[model samples]
Target chain A: MLYLEWVSFLGLLGCGLWIFLKLPIEASQGFPQKIMYLHVPSVITTYLAFFVVFIFSIAYLWKRELVFDQIAKASAEVGLVFCALVLLTGAIWGKPTWGTYWVWDARLTTTLLLFLIFMGYFLLRMSVNDRDKEARLASVLGIIGFLDIPIIHKSVEWWRTLHQPSTLFKVESGQASPSISPELYYPLVASIIVMLVFYIYLLLLRYQTEKRTDRLNQLLADTQD
Target chain B: MKTRTKFVIGGAIIFAVLTALSVQGLQEMTVFFYTPQEVLASPGKFENKTIRIGALVQKGSVEWNAQAIQLSFNITEDGKKFIPVYYAGVKPDLFREGQGVVVEGKMQGPRFEAHQLLVKHSEEYTVETENKKNKEDYYKSIQAQ
Candidate 1:
């Protein structure tokens, strides 16, 4: 985990440099548009993390495995942080491009809903006293949350939309136009890889911490008995 | 296999399907943001294409009809770069001279017409500081000339 942190730190530095220097050159015409790289990728990573939470939640419900339950909880927490980042960065980027921090577009609305749902998921986990019931309820919410992510993603295309279309990976929009130059892409990829590594590392730590806490609680119960 | 294993397998399949579906969905939406200079440089792409252009309003460029239903201005990346903008809707409170804005619409001949205009302003103040800077910059250029 420490190593992952180190890698992520370096990655952040690399990405910062790319964002400041190389991005402006590649996207000479669209200076402010470079925020798409950071914003879009973070959203993608958040979605993937939440998907993990959803999958593990289902697994926990079916198997009733403690490990699966912990995974769900861990991923959901990380997913929430990334989701928050996506919104924050998005709003910042919006200021330059959309002229306002907030809008009532379909995509924006769905994203806010997703953020609230996950926040509620965390709330439910905390309120329930019994661990089993907590996991069960949270898992159900997690599975439901997965359903919303797609709807959030598709809202732009499905309806008359105001939000900008996708930028990074577009098959139908034709070839991959380098919004940012290769100088930036290399660092951007590095940051993503490092973020992924950091995510795995954090999940491991969270699972271990949960396991230790469970052991301690069980021991306490035994002593009382 | 036990019930738990069965559940795990089912979950994995669903996960795979959902991931694939989401990836597929990403294909449909590809949005781009253009600045005023970019739109001016390659005018062809925006002739009838819906595009978003971000820039600061040029001084003395805003014009309004008698009824005030329609307004027009030139947006510039800096003082030197400019793109003509035409909007036929109610502008936001923040739409004014030397204000940062992102106008969304298609290019109508020499003018980049806007259907929806979003006034991009800082939360605290939406004043025209760029005017002072541009004034100084203009004087410096005039001196050089």
Candidate 2:
């Protein structure tokens, strides 16, 4: 786990160097376009983290297990942070390229909606006291919240948007070819892979803390009894 | 009982906020901007109504007044039909001829009065060999500034 953290961190640093020092300036956006390295990967990671939550939440609901719920909660917390990262990096990129930091366009708005939904997921977790009740309700909300990802992902295509459509996910005649040139595309893929590694490391670390806290709470409750 | 009330209130608030935001988002998502064809076809409908028009900046139709700090350009979805827009703001960094833009304002008697101008970029990324020459000129423009 420790090595995983270091590897992701160094991998990101290497990607940053590659973006700035080696990559050619984009034809239209030039220098500020480099922020895509940060923005796109965070977007991908946020999607993946919540996806983890969605899967485990379903698992918890079906199996009625604390471990599944623990995993769901852990991923949701990490996903929330990554979702925030997505918003922040998006705003930073938007200002330089789109001439504004924020817009109420569908793609941007739905992404914000995802962030708020998960924030409420945490708040919902805190509002309930009974462990089973909390897990049950939170899992339901987790599943509902994850459905928004597909909507967010397709917003650019489904409606009018100031934000551009997916660069990497662009399908050409049923083939998976990204819209980016080869020189820039490879590093973007590298960053997304590194970001996923970092996400795994964080999820494991947070899951440990969640498990310990649950055990400590049980111990305290027994002592009080 | 106390936690129940707290939970109800918190949940209600979250639901309310989410509903309100999505309603707004739905509006924007549905029609972030209308096309020139739509706006131009029913000129009376968009007139005096504050709305957005998204289209490409018509080639050779941009006029920027440095002293007045005003920009005027024609936007067109097709080659034949064009809508003239007047914007009283500094040109956006990405603003260029043939670039896509969304202008927010109302339609005047003849021209569109725009208060905000946003450049819409494309998803495709490409590197051109001739861009090298443009990059040098771009650097010169920045250094000169």
**How many residue pairs clash in all the candidates, one count each?**
5, 0
lDDT of 2 by residue, B1-145 (tens): 7975787688678867976987775865666888888888999888789998888888799999989999999987766788999999999988988777889999998799999999888776777745322322222211211
lDDT of 1: 0.69
Worst lDDT 10-window in candidate 1 chain B:
B122-131
Angstrom error at residue A180, model 1: 6.1
For model 1, how does the per-residue alpha-carbon lDDT over A1-225 read when each residue is reduced to its tens digit? 788768777777777776776543332113655665577778888888899998999999889987898888888888888899899988887766555787755577678778998999999988997888788878977997888898877664554334544434423367665433455556556667767776777777777887888789779988999
> For residues B1-145, could you state the per-residue lDDT of candidate 1 as single tens digits?
5964776677688768966885565443323246666678888866888877666778999897748699888988657978888998876654667666667888888878788788643211112223233443222211211
Worst ten in a row by lDDT for model 1 chain A: A23-32
lDDT of 1 at A195: 70
Q: Can you list the residue pairs that collide in candidate 2?
A: none
> What ranges in model 2 sit over 4 Å off?
B1-25, B129-145
Tens-place lDDT digits, model 2, residues A9-78: 8988998888888998888888888888888989988899999999999999789999999999999999
DockQ of 1: 0.07
Model 1's chain A TM-score stands at 0.87
Q: Quote model 2's TM-score.
A: 0.89
